[model samples]
Target: MSGTILDRILEKKKDEVRKLKEQFDAGNESKFQKIPFYDSFIHADKMNIIAEVKRASPSKGNINLDVNPAKQAKHYEASGANAISVLTDEPFFKGTLADLKAVRDVVGLPILCKDFIIDPIQIDAAKQAGANVILLIAAALDDEKLKSLYEYAYRQDLEVLLEVHNEEEMERALVLNPSVIGVNNRNLKTFEVDLGVTERLLSRFGKNHDRIFISESGIKTAKDVERVQKAGAKAILVGETLMLADDIQLTMNQLKVRLR
Candidate 1:
């Protein structure tokens, strides 16, 4: 609690990882069939939406604490979401693995376990809880750990969404030759949001046809979607906006702009 927001969150994850290791079992089976997350963007002409099931955040406090994860996920799929991102972190995000399981039980779209994943046990736990994709932030792990986790998730048959914030992290992310890379607009350590983060990074790194580029966070309108899509993002990971929307379907439809 005394450290930076991300520092505190990672510290909490360490404790959670310890608890997960004690309960880890190799016999666990995934309840839902895995959907190819990266493929959804490849075949799409419209900007894909990775709708997030989030209750709260350390920066925003409580966004929608009473949200039903399963119901929200089903709504997303109906509204043309390409994938679902469930925040499985508890200390800061107020989300649990149970929320992910509930969402998985209802939707066939790829499910992304959006958490501060730092260990193999967390990946195993996410897989057991029915995650088709797991997020690996470049800012959180070193090159060695990042490559290890990226390979480990692939071996577990889970897709990795490698997240980067700036030029430095993007450089590190490219070394893994990730299939899906997301540029997070929010700085985890300071908790400041900026849409330019995605544009700047993509402009510098340029775009790739083989890999999917996603702009995550601070997206709220069609124009915002257009901006990132023009920056070479095939997909957008939206959380707070959808969680706080009065009309979830309409909001999602608006965000699903045609690819530029």
Candidate 2:
């Protein structure tokens, strides 16, 4: 509350991490197989969709508060989504690890634990809950923490989606050389969104076949998909638009433009 949204979220995450450490049981293994998250985008001919099961966010108060995580994930899988991203931060996003477990139980597709991860304990918890991938936001962590967490997730056999919003964050993220990199259009600090954020970052770095590029947030239409696709985004992570869609399958299909 004293700082920006990102700062406030990170502060809150510290408390969550402490609680996670208190109750997390590392010996408990996930029942699901660790699906390859990055490879899905690399092999796809069309724009890969990491369809998100997000109930709410700091920016949008409540999108779909009553959505059943398992049922929603099934819809995404049936609609050709490459992966499923489950927002697991309960305080801000109104999502919990239980939602992730529910989605994992129902979908064969790789599941991404979309949370502001600052500690290794969160990664352990995600793995225990059956997440195949975890998000590492550049804005939420410094250089040291970023590298350590990125390495830790790999050691846990979990994929890391290193997310960046600007040129500086992108520079920091590149040092890790993560297999999958996402250009988030939403500024975590301000909560403002712009699809141009993806275009600018990709334009600056150009395309790297070795690293799967994903454009996250603010993508709603085929035109929005094409805009980022032209800028060399191989995949996209969509949340609110799909959550509010009257027809989930049709909305997903519309956003999944063929990769150029």
Candidate 3:
């Protein structure tokens, strides 16, 4: 699996981070601070939506290829989305930090810079781009790097959504005592989606699990949202469905009806 699509993506990320460090000065980081991501979900009172702005993906290419991230973010905010998730990977996802900045200039909602973050440079990049939250995939980093990156983001005043794809990864994520834990139902290697993956992992945690549980990926309808919430997820990160909807707000309402 060393030459797998995920592996190649990670290799490219490392090279990009190195080049970014050469060009970016850490002292020149953005002065724009942000609210805590956990607070957004807490105040939402229902299953919060982390509406995603993505143009393409490795699994399903060219989704909304002509996306206007700023415009889409405005629509998501108008539709009562609790937060926004901006894809920042350029090669596979056709996303850039520019997209995050564009949305940041327009919306007050918390924005998550979704990417395969392996190095601290990417964390700094996310901060400089006005991202309030950063995604740290457990499968992508070792225990030491995961802890280091988690603390690095915190030091930069950015919140983290530690993503775990399985029980083993969840165990590693819990070691850091993260404030938020997202169960990603999509397999990174095979790109196979199974919504039950979130439910199964969430069930392992009792009511006392203090971390905010977010179900990510494979969520399609109100019923899907309802299913995850029933399984104990406090939030859901939705992408393609809302992105492809003819009426974004209407689709949001449809998915949120379960909460009401």
Once model 3 is optimally superposed onto the true structure by TM-score, how far is the C-alpha of residue 106 displaced, in angstroms?
0.3
Give the alpha carbon lDDT tens digit for every residue of 1-260 in model 3: 48677898999998888888898878876967676789757655667899999999998899998999999999999999989999999999999999999999999999999999999889988999999999999989999999999999999889999999899999999888887999999988788999999889988862544568999999989899988888888889999999989999888887774442
User: Could you tell me which 10 consecutive residues in candidate 2 have the lowest summed lDDT?
Assistant: 204-213
What CA root-mean-square deviation does each model show from the true structure?
A: 1.2, 1.0, 1.4
The reply for model 2, stretches above 4 Å from the true place, is none
Candidate 2 lDDT by residue in tens digits, 11-111? 98999999888988888877678799887678888999999999999998999899999999999999989999999999999999999999988889999
Residue 106 C-alpha lDDT in model 3: 94
Model 3 ranges with Cα > 4 A deviation: 257-260
lDDT of each: 0.91, 0.91, 0.89
Compare candidates 1 and 3 on TM-score and give the better one.
Answer: 1
Candidate 2 overall Cα lDDT vs. reference? 0.91
lDDT score of residue 214 within candidate 1: 91
Q: Where does model 1 exceed 4 Å of error?
A: none
Give lDDT: candidate 2, residue 31: 69
**Total backbone collisions, model 1:** 0
lDDT for residue 36 in candidate 1, whole number 0-100: 91
Measured against the true structure, the TM-scores of the candidates, in listed sequence, are 0.97, 0.98, 0.96
Better of 1 and 3 by lDDT: 1
Assess the local accuracy of residue 195 in candidate 3 as a C-alpha lDDT between 0 and 100. Answer: 91
How would you order the candidates by TM-score, starting with the best?
A: 2, 1, 3
